[model samples]
Target: MSPTDLGPGGPATIGAAVAHHAAHIPDHPAIVCEGRTLTYQQLHRGANQAARALAAADARAGSRVAYLGVESEWYYELYVACARTGAVLVPINWRLTPPEIEHILRDSGAELLVASEDHLAALDGIRGDLPQLGAVVSLAGYESWRAGRDPADLPDTTDRQTPVVQLYTSGTTGLPKGVVLAQRSFFAVREALADAGLDWIDWQPDDVSLIGIPGFHVGGIWWASQGLVAGVTNVAMPFFDSSVAVGLIRGRGVTTMCVVPAMLRLILREPGVGKADFDQLRKVVYGGSPIASSLLTEAVEAMGASFAQIYGLTETGNTSICLPPADHQPGSPRLAAAGRPYPGFAAKIIDGDGGPVPPGTVGEVCLRTPARMLEYWGMPDATSATLVDGWIHTGDAGYLDEDGYLYICDRIKDMIIVAGEKIYPTEVENALIQHPAVAETAVVGVPDDRFGEAVHAFVALDPGAQATPRDLATFLKGRIATFKIPVRFTFLERIPRNPSGKILRRELRERFWTDRVRQVN
Candidate 1:
């Protein structure tokens, strides 16, 4: 392996430069959050102190530490502390139910849990069920614990290959799966970002980044790491609110921001949306789901040409595919594609037998990259199923054109079959989103006696716009083949989505076929 590959003393591990920046940029703003700002020196000291506390509590390297908090400066410090101590940081989604949270806490064998005051109540309800959880530290209580400790001499024992994070899958199907990402995986993502022309969005000493996505997701964790790695300032919001995001961008002169499609839609719909100058904004990275071409065009017009798109999953670090600013043209062919594979990442479509598919033939998208996850936590069977012959089966159905641009068709499991024809939900959803009345749409397969499975759509309309099921069906009838049109349409106030804004088709299907013997194939 090259020296650039993650190992001891490599630039990929947070410990590689933590002390360097802590001493050099001690006074530089490391994080700006909720009217309070922390300098690099403070962050370093805070993380060190937290590490000492964990050590004092018998937490050792490779130990699991569950972080149960919303976005906060303290949350970042805890993450860094885990990295410094060689502990696996497992971030729990605050949106999950108590039982769901309990399952992760137990399954990961987490001995330490750092939770916010709001989340503490939830933990209290399930504390008795988690015998393995040794300690529950509250963010609000950390200050008192560190009052007497000297943080400068805390022990640092991080190794480059050590697992840094265990991110749980969104679990739209069943229980969430834990994806283990090592320090090497993170370093690979940073290197890929630099190699993919995204270095221009690199953090500077004075740069403040507005983080709108939930810290539990990849967008928040990876982007936050990018800022920290460059010793730049990061401004975090506890939860997503369009007015607050707009205020931070304009008020704090935020130079960079990471957002999801729904967040962008909310920001664009804000009443004072057009009033914000956003002159300080340098780049707006959008991902998590396929972005509508129309939304991309409007975003460029609203936020300038700073919008960039990234495509990746938790199991593949954070970014493997990137559509750079140069590809954001009004009618560029690349806009329809998911851009090119990141440097050091090789992607291809494979058929049922695992043979490479020819260009333009839809199949499973497989990736081979340094940034791939170590394994699915405690799931050797699933891991073996996904990672075969050094390639990660992405389970996404897409084709690569002759130019090597990736055109994502849909999820392999989400393909709708109607009257012997295959219909991709993303295609139908993409076409539906173009309509002015539609805000969001999710397509799923529903039971039908004639057709083995029929295409069904659940839509959320734009504010003050009304459209019936027949109207939407008629709108799509001419755009696609007759077989591809949705057989049933349900107008909902809002579609159910996971924390990352990916629509929950499994939930939609369960409502109709939960009791039926024939569940989704």
Candidate 2:
């Protein structure tokens, strides 16, 4: 894009980017979903109509418009439409329960809701309970709803600092918190990277990217934003399924995709994946949790795609620390690290007192980056506690090496203190999964009068495989330190996790602490 087309400050906003592409590449493919492809012209026209409809519904600059649906052309149109009208889009997690959905709608003060037919039904009884909601429209009849409206001119309303997305954190601890992300925090950093001429992995106009993760995640929207901003064709999968994903990559010639570690593991476990053609795939970016180096090794061997690991929180734009393609080789020590920060991002480890920790010492990971969120909506205390001196206090515990590779240990809250020894659950779970019969495992700290807190592991056995807790305990005896070994084992049909694929240790600890006043021992 030319400097004259960018939004007054130096970089273009998402709305500006889309407008530039529509004007220059009108015939180019933009979004493909459910067998229908929308060219840039179609996408822009639909977004124009949606923006006019929403504008008529009283949505203006800074107004909130919530959406409840799986990914589709309608979803993308509404997302861009919100940018055209300067309304903030809140993409709801369709996997969430009705009450949870209601909580987010209320919390975001969403004035209008655009939902799929099924999602609209999910809010049937609770629709009246929302006081700030001005209207709710169903995607099933979205075309008819906008029938009378003509394609309106793109409004010159939004700027880089406009809060375009308000992503609510998946509430594992309690109620989900809204993490407000502005265009500058989301796209300005990428603009900086381009200015620096760093193009290790970037969106090319010819790239056919895949949007597979649920749109509720920052990574999901952020991934799609890259494709949209760069004028690349994007294939939108309603949801990520291992089998369906392989087909999309092979059938559509997908060049890039962003996925979580669990999704990659599942795809590898899928039958015939070894024989599948991945010659067209250039990059597969995984994040939201640390990829077990063992799993990463297998993925690297199976798919020809270059693997990159991104580490960040919803509060920090999509990614600040990235393990680039060069560091993904098997046996590379950097594979276990979260790579160095991006060109414009900086990070450090801080002790409990907020002072810097020495290199190689584990502490709370803190990041100062252009992509950091504005604030946690309605959470002044949390915003204050998390954002200090322009640095985001990431709850994750990790250490930075001399070469600047950051190695993640575990969440500070999830760290188990047993008999004065600190035991990160992932360390124990990693050792447990090495057992042949162990399919999945989750480790959490449970109350114990003997050690103040005891480690308890929940294990899911492989199909048609059986192993007693004693057998697994014997197997783990020499693998990890005895102090780090789980004190108790409980068999489970499946391990519980949030949608983003992070294990819900709090859910596993609930049964053990049902009668206790506090969760902690």
lDDT of each: 0.76, 0.80
Q: Per-residue lDDT for 1-521 in model 2, tens only? A: 52123344432677777777778787888899878898888888888888889889998888999989889988888888887778999998776667668889999999999888887876899988998999789888888777677875676578777899999874334467899998876675567667677654577657889886777788889888878887888999887778988888888999888887667777777787764657788888877655555677877877778877787878888788888888876677777687778887898999989898889998999988898999999989889988998999887888999988888765665766553334667767877999999999998988765445789999999999999888988898756657667879999999999999988887898788798643443
Error of 2 at 419 (Å): 31
TM-score of 1: 0.78
- What TM-score, over all chains together, does every model reach? 0.78, 0.79
Candidate 1: stretches off by over 4 Å: 1-12, 153-155, 171-173, 193-201, 415-521
| Each candidate structure's count of clashing pairs | 0, 0
For residues 96-171, what per-residue lDDT tens digits would candidate 1 score against the true structure?
6566688789889999988888879856878888888998888789777655666784556666678889988633
Worst 10 residues of 1 by lDDT: 1-10
Tell me, what's the RMSD of every candidate? 11.2, 10.8
- What's model 1's lDDT at 304? 72
Error of 2 at 459 (Å): 16
